[model samples]
Target: MRHLMASAALAALVAGTAAAETPKDQLIVAFNMNNVLTMDPAAITGGEAVQILNNVYDALLQFDDEGRNLEPRLAEAWEIAPDNMSVTFHLRPDMEFASGNPVTAEDVAWSFKRTLTLNLAQASGLKSRGYSAENADEMFVAADPQTFVLNLPEPGDPKMILMYLTQAGIGSILDSKLVMEHDDGGDMGQGWLTNNSAGSGAFSLQQWRSNEYVLMTRNDEFWGEAPAMKRVLMRHLPESQSQRLGLEQGDLDVGLSLAASDLKALEADDDITVKTETSAGFYYLAASAADEKYANPKVREALRYLIDYKGINAAIMPYFGVERQRVVNSKAFGALSDPGYALDVDKAKALLAEAGYPDGFDTSIRVISTQEFLDSATAIQGTLAQAGINAEIITGDGGQIYGAMRAREFELLVGRGGGGQQPHPDSNLRALVYNPDNAQEAGLTNYQGWRTSFFDPELNGLIEEALVEPDQAKQTEMYETIQQMIDEKVIPIQPFSERVVTAAFQDNVQGLMVDPWTTRFEGVTKGE
Candidate 1:
């Protein structure tokens, strides 16, 4: 009944808009902008921010739209030292910032320095690699106007470092001169950067009103090919129905955030096309190791079988993720393609009885209030109850739910995250399985393993060994071993599905990359 009212209102809205065709020289997109907190590259978090920043600022290197290989952007080429302790990048000589300032290697060095010095969200990737403000001068060096050298502070993979830089606006190169001129006191221009852009990319931020819209105009001084669209507007349309109506009415050129039902509807429509791309993350059920009931390995094992993976995937997880039991992304190197788990209520019951919970135990599940998350949790709740385990579903916003997980205070939670941005095994393992310090005072919230209070020294050592292993064949073997160890040991996070991002766009829109991390407006165009 409620859905009927929504559909009626949507029809009315579309009728009111008159199905006017959007301007050929402009692209209008709608997506949920709840996560776009700031424009400061150093302080921004989440994929939404990365999608916006990717066009406003240019990174030294970028992953291809399909996230398969590295491609050059600001840096024309690069070389790694034989010692594997440093990497040198050669900047393009013709690059200029939106303000017409010539881009130099010093700007690259300074941008990295500022990110580390400010110690914001973007600093975590570099900080995890042992790059700190105290060592910024030695680690980030500008050998010349076009040569920028990066010295590794730790003995790890330089390739992995490059991959980390390709995520979450962390590697954005700023126009240091323009940024400093707007600096207020010693904030490192962070205050000014929150609302401004000083990049050499194909687009420049014009105005951004939180939860309303983000307006970007093509950068006249862009170093690369000129953008086909003169202007791009990203409207904050959190409701999926609104996006569907807008797309159907030709009010929106693209819809980045739409519900599964809406996407399916659009897929059948002749005027719209829906594309699904593999994203970097996992949808998993996490158990807090600190909880007494879940502390037992047998209990954790029982919980895994109690989940109806097939049912959830078929019914609720469509368009959100594909069934993926392994922590590593299937597209990543050395990843195992097949999933090995299935629902076994009898086995779950026996395991629970063996774990001294023959009658089953009562627990609650923490999940975000979003449709997909809440529905998944509710489905899991039903499966657990079939095994005699009484489960309660507690729903809240992202901050409230994930906050409890980060504080290590939750019993069990349904969440999406294990970090697969880099097409490497360590990227997922580091976030999902590696926990060097289990002590609560250590405050390593960046690692999901630490957040769940699950730590294995042997697993940690194996991961470290694989990362620094020089031989490609040998490194691949070590990674396979690591995945086996996690599977055999039953880690705190049990992945049920690998995430995917789906978007619907007008059929005439061309060169639209759906992956948020690699999306760029420079090549996007509309047909008459």
Candidate 2:
């Protein structure tokens, strides 16, 4: 009965048919929500979770529509200390949560501390910048009822810390009192938060069924601009064909997970608009340096020349990514917008011969069974074959593929990585290049550099130096030097393309943010 009603309402929303529970003012969006494992801010990962949480939870800061600049959210104003050791944020006065509890500085402090105390997925952003549970009290403090102060635990970039906080769900400030009331045996409300919400954003979670759908209702107690949509129904329509059908039949207001072909077809629809934006991360080819064949720098350099970046971007990466050779994304502050490497079978074969592999060795490429990944791997396999390298493609689910990479067991893999969420160079460099410990038991699987066994003390030192550099001009120069160093050293990871996200929405909807990191449904509205 509920499903029938939802379908009827969605159809009526655009068809002007009989009304149901879903009002015309409500929004119906379809997207693949398979990655939304939990509602707990600290435990949630991926852009889908962040997209939902952005409306349900208000973070200290938020990214602008472009996902480049930071704007005020819960924090009205923020300032970094001259010493770059601390950042203070001034909260707006007279704020209240959905329960009418006065939003206080203690709540903000507790929320930040909770992430570290739980040490969940979201805590890594803070942990990478020297924050820990031991120093939680000193690092995250409430100076007053309307002020929150974040003190750096070590020499690091305060700007990066602010950028980390700008990620909606991860850095969300929770209502401590409400969460504590649901705490189960010092679990810090993890179990309860997995199903419930304790936030002060423009919307509140009404219902969520795993891999089914999520329903959010507007929060009347919201202190900021009132939301336009009374309700938002995010249906778990994973299949692109279903989304296309729904959109074509006037049943879906937005289809976020449509295929490139479907999106191209929808571009011809007069009532639909397709939007695309360059998102964080890179789709690259990585080789495990621990393998004897890939251990030599000459082999790594040959691997770089073997990738047909232009061909891959033009063919398989139409709606997925664009050709980008640099590790740092183009939107970042210190990013270099130049294509450094191209396809050259001759160069690759010469380098391979120099590396003592004139006959070319056999290698296995692990890739996810998804369409884009498998296709990209196949293209690379064809190119590698031309250079006399026999490449075998191994396909599996994300867990089977990335888990092998995390265990440092893969020889070669076509994958997407390089955490570029913070819009800073260190965000990508720290994940893709910096490797402090090369020992087998180091167990630093979180760092891709360690996973691929690419360790350079000088590169690590340079990244560290660049992070703490105060002068903007000198810091940018340092980043340029690091990029050159990466090329000269023939880093294991060769970024062929930068990720780009595409979505199709009804033309009637206004103020829609296409990028998941900055997407907020609050300002979205349906036209009459």
Q: What is the TM-score of each candidate against the true structure?
A: 0.91, 0.93
Error of 2 at 192 (Å): 3.8
Task: State the lDDT of candidate 1 residue by residue for 1-528, as single tens digits.
Answer: 997884564444323335467778778889999999899999999888888888899988988766878888889899988878999999988789999999999999999999999999889878878989999999999999999999999898888888877764788999999999998989989999999999988889977889888878899999888889887888889999999999998889899999999999999999998988888889999999999989889889988897778888888888899889899997678898655688899999999999999989899999999888899899889889998889888889989999999899899999999888888899999989999999999999989999999989999999998999877799989998888888789888998889998899999999999988778878899986
Error of 1 at 244 (Å): 1.6
- Cα deviation of 232, candidate 1, in Å: 1.0
- Candidate 2 ranges beyond 4 A from true positions: 1-24, 184-188
Candidate 2 on 1-528: residue-level lDDT in tens?
998896665545434323322355788889999999999999998899998999899988888878888899888999999888999999988998876788888888899899999999998878877789999999888999999998999988888888888776658988898999999999999999898888898999977888888888889999998988888888899999988877777678888889989998999999888988889899999999999999999999999989888889999998899889999988888787765688999999999999999989899999999888899999999999999999999999989999999999999999998989779999999989998998879999889999999999999999999999988899999998899888889899999989989999877888888888888899897785
Worst 10 residues of 2 by lDDT: 13-22
Model 2 CA lDDT for position 177: 88
* C-alpha RMSD of each candidate structure in angstroms: 5.8, 3.1
Clashing pairs in 2: none
Whole-model lDDT per candidate: 0.88, 0.88
